[model samples]
Target: MSDYEISNVDPNQELAEQGSDNFWLIAAIGLGLTTIGIGIKDFFTSRKLKQEREKNKLYQEVLKKHQAQINELKNEKERREYRDRLWAENSN
Candidate 1:
C-alpha cells in the first residue's frame, strides 16, 4: 500500500457540488425579486392610469356643459342685436 494509492474520492467534487447549489440559490432569488418588482410597478401604473382617465372624463363633461351655456348666450345676443337694428331702421 502506497501513501497516494487506491483512493478514488475527489475533494474537488465536493467543492463543485457546493458551487452549483450556491448558483441555483442565487438564480432563484434573482427571479423572485424580478417578478415582485414587475408586479408592483404594474399595479401602480394601472392605478395612475385609471385616475387620469376619470379626471379626463370629468373635464369633458364640464366642457360640454359650458359649451351649451355659451351657445344659449350667443343666441340671446343675436336676437337682441336684430331687435335693435329693426328699431333703428323704423326710426330712420
Candidate 2:
C-alpha cells in the first residue's frame, strides 16, 4: 500500500469531524457573550435616562422660579425687558 494516496483523502470527513467536535461549544460561548453585551448596554441606557430625568426636574424647578420672578415684574415693559435679558443670559 502507498503511504500517500490522493484517492484516499476525504475533505468532507475532516470537515465533519471538526464541526461536530466544537460547533456547539462555540455557538454557546458566542450567545453568552452577546447576552452580556446587551445587558451592559441596557444598564447604561437606563442610567443615562435616569440622569436625564433628574436634570429635567431641576430645569423645571428653575424655570418655575424664573417665571414667578417675571410675573412679579410690575409692568409689561419691565417683564418683556427682563425676559429678553434672562433669555440671553441663560442661552450663554
- TM-scores across all candidates? 0.82, 0.60
Q: Model 2 TM-score?
A: 0.60
lDDT (Cα, 0-100) at 22 in candidate 1: 100
Model 2 residue 50 CA deviation (Å) reads 0.4
The candidate maximizing lDDT is 1
TM-score for candidate 1, residues paired by index: 0.82
Model 1 gets an lDDT of 0.97
RMSD of 1: 3.2
Stretches > 4 Å off in candidate 2: 1-18, 75-92
Q: List the residue pairs that clash in candidate 2.
A: none
Candidate 2 on 57-89: residue-level lDDT in tens?
999999999998887765777879899999999
Best by TM-score: 1
